[model samples]
Target: MPVTTELILARHGEAHCNVAGIVGGEATCTGLTDQGHAQVRRLAVRLDQEHTTAPMSALYTSPRRRTVDTAAHLADQLNLETRVEPALRGLDHGEADGRPWTAIKRRFGGRPQQYPHRPIAAGAETWNAFISRCRAVLRRILDKHEGERVLIAAHGETIEASFALFLPLPLDDTELAGQITGHSCLTRWQRHRNTFGHDVWMLAGHNDTNHLRSPMEVIT
Candidate 1:
């Protein structure tokens, strides 16, 4: 027997800071830009069509403004309530919470590996901490919502962390640097009964962005 669940992970729309190349960590409260809003609207419309009657049972969102807004719109479309999960928040950047990427690259280009663990300027959290929290949160969500389909609205870092967990990779700065993207991904997990009386969770789909590139127009 196979116990399966579908997890839809969506990156929040482009924030004003994103367009400006700002490093928006957990502390940053930047909302979505106009284009970002349009993208979310398009996503909602598409979701509505796919799930006109059979929709996700619940919706989860990070505490950030952009995620909250995106979740709100999605909740309206699905007729579901939105729940906030602080653990789903973006990586905390301590002192460099809102600095531009260019500035960080300029200041620490030679030592990129050390940047994630460094204090970031004042008292920001390290990349290691961010990965740990995100992994824990995702695990909790999976356990709590077993066998149900869920939609999560979160930041780029949050999505990356979730992917890394299912894929089992070391969360290094170089790895994180290459994971950020605009499209959404679908990850499905299935629980199977083994001959030895053990249950295993297997990956069904990983990093799928088919919906974004379909013939339908995805504003993002």
Candidate 2:
């Protein structure tokens, strides 16, 4: 029988750069703020409630401190081991690390054409590369746990990049750029056996954050 999997995508809580208007990338490192901790606490509670019956089978996270910390909390609730995976790390901003958004805008005279496609100053990973890395990591996770309930704590950029990979929409680069926010979602994928004995993947959910009651639920 083909196996179906559920992925709970949780964006890491706020970091200092997130509140300081700085563009955070793999190169620029920051820890979670007090509010960030609180946000994750709320997230932990929400996940506990949602999975009270279903139960998560495993917990996974980026090696980044923010994501690791968030996954630790979820792991506590689920009694699962937290696995740190480097492939889940945020995009490499290269030269843009620690640069304020205002400075970036000033350099470009405005917001660049679109994210990923738009170069940040001079050095940064292109959108295609960002998407490819995210795809690779997500695929590895899916293959590792084909039919289990898995939880991933990652960055907003990582989540958005994965969204682009799973959903076939007419989202431009700019729109794709704006999709990531500090939030969490529940997404599932099921493998269906066809008449020819082949398994096909199906879309279950995308960016569902009902746990976030409102904008207030998002802690900066």
lDDT of 1 by residue, 1-220 (tens): 6455666777777677778888776677678888777677677767777776657877999998888878877887678899999889876666677788778757755323355555455576666777778999998998898877788887777766776677666856553444535733444455666777676766665555555556665433
In model 2, state the lDDT of residue 122: 68
Candidate 1 residue 89 Cα shift, in angstroms, is 0.6
**Candidate 1 at residue 48, lDDT?**
73
Give the range of the ten consecutive residues with the poorest summed lDDT in model 2.
211-220
TM-score of 1: 0.80
- lDDT (10s digit) by residue, model 2, range 1-220: 5556666678877777778988776666676888777777677777777678878887889887778778877787667799888888876666877899899768765554365466666676665666678887887888898777788897776766666666633335563444635444445445667778787666565566665553333322
Q: What is the lDDT, from 0 to 100, of the residue 38 in candidate 2?
A: 72
lDDT score for candidate 2 against the true structure: 0.70
| Alpha-carbon deviation at 171 in model 1, angstroms | 4.5
For model 2 the local lDDT of residue 188 reads: 48
> Residue 205 in candidate 2 has what lDDT?
59
Find the candidate with the highest TM-score and give its number: 1
